[model samples]
Target: MKNSTLLLAIASAMLLQAAPAVAQNNVPIRKIKAVRPTTELTLLDRVESDTHRKIYQYNEYGYITSVMEYNKEAEQWVLDTDNSYRQEYVFNAAGQCTARTSFNVDKAGNKTTEKNKAEVEVIGDKTWERYYKEYPDSTTHISEAFAYDKWGNCVEEILYGYDSYSKMETIRTYNKREYSGPVDKYTDNSNYESFKNGRLLYYLKARGFDDQITMNTNELFVEEFRKIVWQTENDKLYRREYGLDRGMDIQVGSIEKNMWKSSESEFTLNADGTRPVKETVRSYDETGEVKYDYTSHTYTWDDRGRLLASFEYNESPSEVSYKGEYTYADDYAKTLSLREAIAELSCGNQIYPEDEFLQFGRIATSSYYYAEDGDKGESTYEWNADGQLTGGKWSETCITSEPDTDNPTTRTDYGETRVGYNADGHMAWKIDHSITENEFIKIEYLYDKEGIWTGEAEYDGDSWDGPWTKEGERGNARARKRLATRAATTPKFIDDMTDGSHNIENNDGVWNTNGNYNVTDGVVTGGGYQQTLASNASVPANPQYNYTDPLMPLEGEEDEEVFTNEAEAVWSYTWNPQKGDWESEWSPTEAKRVYNKDGNIVADIYDGNQTIVSTITYRLDDDGRLIEEIYSKGGNITYEYLPGTDYLLESVETAADNSRNVCHYYYSKHNYVDPTGIESIKRNDVSTPVWYDLQGRRITTPTSKGIYIVNGKKVMVR
Candidate 1:
């Protein structure tokens, strides 16, 4: 991430406006007190979409060894550190992450480990995204860029996935005051806004997505939004919103009551004027199922609020309570396992929930909590001088401890991609990458006069490697293609490359030469990349699905499946050359395998060739991991793919004496059997896990070992 793009000066200007500013009662700021968020979830959309995040760290402390996490559904403790994360901390003589990194976790039998740093990058007034594990096959990174405004409203933010897929498979931006809600539906084209000078202004993008409604509803158009103060005989304040959904004209529909508005709405400033306060808000469903509710808040003393500790709650009568004395120590913040945090929150020990809507059965989206009975629990906290929490870990993986291995030998390299940026700080980019063990790659950008990226190239651990031609933009290179006859036997579209051939050397010490296999009218053809008959194979990530022999498509079925590269198909008959007409004698075998010009098949043909005739050739993923297989018998070639061993296919070769060769043995270090009685088989290569049996014997003893039951304590029988 680049600094200039974040615009620190703009943020400073807003906070430094000439208008009289609200000041905290002259109290010396201690460590930043507690900080809170509107809504928080362990995993967004409740999905474990982020499975391969890595971790990293810096600043003179050899502090945390690793961090891990368990999801909300976990019955017990779980680990989180499976990816690379970075931590930045300022230390005194003792090397504690004074300004950053604060959290802790609990160990099994009885010990507690602490973490003082998290993945952080502080540079100038802005912190760039650092401590990220580089992905193979990707020149652009999947990242979150942030910019804070005067009132703490996010001024600018971008979330994007930068690999080649669809034009907007990645890139989402959240702009405050500067833009309004997206009037479109392309995630990459979405925009948001704040207000300016009493007039409605917007953070706008001609291109981007606008939030859409479900099936039967109309699309809601954003009218206006932003925060600002106004004055008169009596100072007043408000958080305004403007909206429209299709046929309706734009109008102010709803708002978060009495905020930093120019005039007052429904609340008042008490004698304790600037002190922190909580205002509970509510919303309910038709059945009064207590759908939603949450406490609105204003932090009191800068660093004294406990953003992580949830206040107590009693439901039947409807009551909420917090702000209590710590039972055992001067310090109450502590780190716990994911389960520990949930337990405290479940009971009344932590998180402050505003109870105004107790009758409605609704509360704020996020809350905080600390441990209950022990000085030895899980969880940790960090505070700024004013006693405010800048940021802290949720689970240990939030500020975990793990062996450092930021630089990995493996990485992905998806070819070249272009990035586009709008004036409001919105960005869109495509990326090309690949995964290879023999090398590393860096993405390079080529810009046009407008400073927009028109070109993109790669540094293959060596030099700037540009693709052969430019796509549409200036510096980006895209391969060109031609759509041939659409009638019947033509492959969808042909990649009109100048020249090329498939030359592969097999274990038999033979370098096979390949040629084209294009179909024209009724004859199954040949022309381009060289491919053989018996030993050729398919490729991955991108593959061309072409039929070896033309066959009539199903009656009236224009489309059978989505395709990347397709050639016209035909019918196989018993004429002189053994090929004939449509319907009467033609039957369709759903496309199982696709091929390239060199006569070699491409992509995974798993589902297509499931009928399984005989021999097949396999195709690998971007990492050479087997993805599919293809089979051919003259004009009757078909493709098939199956679950495979990571390295090679495992099969039993019947020997004359009845002996079998076990080709592969998979291993799992983080192996765990779930409630379904099935054991997961991924590698532990990082954090270590434990397993137990009915008699309390440690069962995860390395070798796949003896017989083990499912979730029920396994009785190991040798």
Candidate 2:
């Protein structure tokens, strides 16, 4: 059977397993470690290695106090002094972290006594945090303050950085919040207010200001300042505006820097003030005085409050427009409305009801872009019975105008992708086909018995049938062995551009050796120049050449010899002023070119030259692919390609002595996959344990209500 067919059959046999449902809990985990089994026979034979291990120490209140890391050295577990360091935290009786300290090793491999510490102070409805770091050569200090309203919503915040050398304190960021009504009022879940309130909550969360504590330490503060205004009518949010400012470097007691209004966004609700119907955004220049860009998006919804269509207009130095139409499966009635889903998620409720969720299958969308030359695209997705995406196809048509002409041309591009899952619900293989390029690639994943992804192999082919060659392999287990075998057997090639063919020709079209010729009906016409260089004995490095058209003789230069063809003008000549003639220059012996079975040049050897100054040898793989080249002078170049394809991965040029790299060039294609599973996880409904703080410090428990690292994701806990 063909490799592609066999792979597809195998993938098809692997039935997709449903993702294990998770239950919400508040259980605090004391310690956690990820270990791999030493043997493939049994998973129970797990071994702890120095590569990954961590120890946690916590206080009585479930808050972490300190952490120590160890590594296996000489078969003995010891502190990883070079990388492992202690981070300690101090908390008050109220379970709030009061201070934090971290240590690290210096360049000399010595653990420095110097440390960085952050202290926090909390008063009624207000908080302040100060951070100090001392290094061998420099010290840094930062301070932040926050104020909250009666509803426990932070209304103002300011951050400052101190420069000890200059004794200057610079304001880093500032933010202010205002609401037409109490912030708590937007949480009303009544049917009449659910839609508006849900949208308001979604918007607030997207802006990183939905919660009181999280708003104070928002990382966005480091990049820009914001002024948020929420307007409500009779407890219903009607509009919200966000104004952004940047370039905060004002010193304390000094005139404030001219803060540029970087961007602004305004959202307006529908007629009943139950859903957002329009959103407008504008961007300004660095000086904030000139408006450079503007975008407005208007949305329409069905009777059930499901998004139906959206239109967008953007003016960024030029005007462009976009439109998108959405279609849901007929069974969408079984699913919650968009507004209800958002509201439920905002209230920490599961967005999907187990059994009925999959009934809402496939969402087809069509989009259009309008500008100088308009284009349109359509995308359709397929979902399995379990709501897992099985395949998808996208096609677009674009219209472009010919250069310097009013004639317009239209081209269509299309692509399709298919995904298969293993019994563990992990993706097993994926096929991506670019119909426009007549190329397709497949990636098959390998996993251990426990369904842990160990490695993957990529294959490339022209069609969906028969031939499929492995192009790449990644991961540490089986892939490593395959790579070792390949290195031992595979030959290399040198992609020499001296021939002026191959990738450069295939990608950029026929070369225009000279601009004098015009191509029409595949026939070359017009005058062409043939130049020959002559090196002066005094200045060999500076050679001179002159362009001459064989058909057009020079007016005053009758002695100039004319050539009938370009090939005859290849040799250089010297001007003999004494004899008023041109003589052939002393030239090095010609190099003999050797070709391989594939008609590719394998070597170029100059036999007459005693030193063999320009000798080079080439090596190719079994499939006639070039992999390496050697120069007589000692310098060499090695090429790597995707395992089964002609696609070059990287090229390494070694110095003449082969001791160091002279140059390196890499060309690798990267495919981006959505982090969320096939069915978008718009909101995470499961609660996982928090093991670390935002600063990447291991924390047994969260000491404050802010953002914490949970399963490698930053989650905000209220």
Candidate 3:
């Protein structure tokens, strides 16, 4: 049986305990206080990763103020200086977070000023939160305002775009649900809607107060509608949907689900009330009616409540059926305890939900069988006393049957992985072996005093090797350690190479450094000489970036060097007073980029000295996919896409030769934003008119006037 079925059965048993003590089938349960969100991040004791580690530092108010990343070197944690990634938070006197800022360090180990990349400001204790993003020019890229209901649910959200003349808003309204004791059903009937440019884009209206049925094993009321939904498009009516639930009475060994027969779902819990033995799942047609096909599952568990075996019965003959069995370690409890102890010691602060203490045990080995022509697989796990999952091995065999032939063929494959952990429970060594290929790979790890993983080395061979070592040739490994707390430090030389040392000088308790460069006191100060690496790959070699006539490379397109090829390109810029930034426009001396209203790259201009070298302009279809690209160098490409779809490329045509390439496209599902929040207008492509009702159904016609989603936008039809 699927894990979900077991979870559902457990949920049903828990519900029975809600009845009066004398009438309840199970013993009364103790309730634990829920953890508050504000203190959750600060309460973490420690977090360790192979290459990085983040230590949460909190203030007196128990609010996280700074998150620092450290590097592990020589078995100790050291301040990482190579990567520029840090977050600082501020909280008000009320202990509520007031603001947060993120910063990054560059390859040269220069820490940018705080609040460089993005920031969020919280206002109005319980009602609203505002967020902001900062661009390279120290300007706002976007901002958002959110309003919350008493239940801490976001009820209204407004998004403000920085560069485009567009706005989006979302509003949600909810009603209190009625109580009917243990067997009663309730609904919030929350209404949600989204609008773009003051036009409705999406909506959902859900209603509640449904009659709940319970199964008595004899005339049992076993089904209930949690809520019914109505969906519409362009104010046109579409389809309706219902949310269902199956209730089981734990007192009696018998269970009946979906008694009302409105939806298709049934689950049965064993009289023991601890495990689920069987479950049935049904398919539904687009109209919300149950289909004839269904699936059944049966499960067997050990006396300790651990699932030992499971079987799935498929109603359809075309699909393969599944059966799996599990086993536990001989000393399962002792091993589990040791592992838990190591975890507790490593974290220092081990706080888990109250329910975790009573959770089920882990599996040691598992085997699976595919009944359609006999395919099988199995895996085994190994662990250490430190609670580390040391390594695992898996093997699979496939038996293939040929049509009209009595002979059957088989193939087998297998692999194994072994891992060793450090004293802190961090994985320090790993070796992988593939029996089919007769190949083996090994990796070694190193850390600093702070338990931050800072180095790694790898080797591959046909024969096995010894434990990890530090003297082997390095494998793309690097590390940088911070020297002081926001103070200038002298540059150091390691192996005669200038170490990329940069520092954050404290300016009135605010750590500040230039962004992507060496700077101090709000000035561009030079440190170790910096130079931009030129691209080594030929301009036309990189198909992903090189565009023909009428199509220029997008900004930052050439930054990626596929083969570490670098060539320097001369560049100069003209200042744009209007935008308060240095940019190349009228008298361009370097490359420049321009974006259209929908934020798509519209054009790229390349200038040499005072003359224009080349120009590329891109045209996009209504769905935002590139339809045509024009390059000044003499050639262009035009793209043809299917209409009324996601602009799937149907064909490509080159202007030079008129040669055509065609393709067929398929998609799993259309992407649509939920109505609970505003979706940014990233692409203003034209879309085919489609209608939908609040129930999320596609409607062909409108039966009555109402609010509906048309082409992903809201419309009111009368």
RMSD (CA, Å), each prediction:
31.1, 24.2, 31.8
Cα displacement (angstroms), candidate 3, residue 524, comes to: 61
Candidate 1: where is the Cα deviation over 4 Å? Answer: 1-276, 282-317, 321-378, 381-718
TM-scores, all models, native as reference: 0.19, 0.37, 0.32
Superposed by TM-score, candidate 1 places the C-alpha of residue 357 at a distance from the truth, in angstroms, of 30
Residue-wise lDDT of candidate 3 within 1-718, one digit each (tens)? 1221111111110000011112110101110012233322203323344444544433333333344556668877777643324555554565444455556554343447544322234355335555556545555543555554344444344444343333222211222221111111111101011101011112222221123222112322223223222233332222232333333322111222332233333434445544556555655653556776454666776766655777777786334398878776543432223223212212221121111111234447778787866877776767667445566776778887776798898988787767676666666666767677775667565453345443344555565564332222222122223333223433321111223434322111111112122334543333322211111111222222211111111111122453332232333343233443334322324643333434334444445543446666666656655666667765676654333332232224355555443322221111122223111111122243476887889987656645567677654343
User: Candidate 3, 267: how far from true, in Å?
Assistant: 3.7
Q: Write the per-residue lDDT of candidate 2 for residues 1-718, one digit (tens) a residue.
A: 1111111222221212222111101011111112222322100001122243334333223222333445556776666554444455655665456666656654333445535666666566545455566533455455555554455444566666555655665555566553322443222211213333333321211223222123233343333333334445452332333333334533222222433345555556666655556666656666555465354767776655555666767665234476666676544543554334323323322221111112222454434455545767766667677756676777777788875799889998788878788776756667878788876877676554344443455666667662775442112234234435564433111112132222211101111111122333433222222222211011100000111111111111122222212221232334343543334444345433332324334444443322334756566668765567767778876765434444333446677866643221112111122222111011133344546775789876665545566676654433
Error of 2 at 454 (Å): 18
Please provide, for model 1 over 527-577, each residue's C-alpha lDDT reduced to its tens digit, 9 standing for 90 to 100: 333211221222332111111001101011012232334332322222122
Greater TM-score among 1 and 2 belongs to 2
Alpha carbon deviation, residue 594, candidate 1 (Å): 17
Clashes of each: 148, 7, 51
**Clashing residue pairs in candidate 2 (N, C-alpha, C atoms within 3 angstroms):** 471-643, 492-626, 492-627, 492-628, 493-626, 493-627, 493-628
Output the lDDT of residue 582, model 3.
Answer: 37
How many backbone clashes are present in model 2? 7
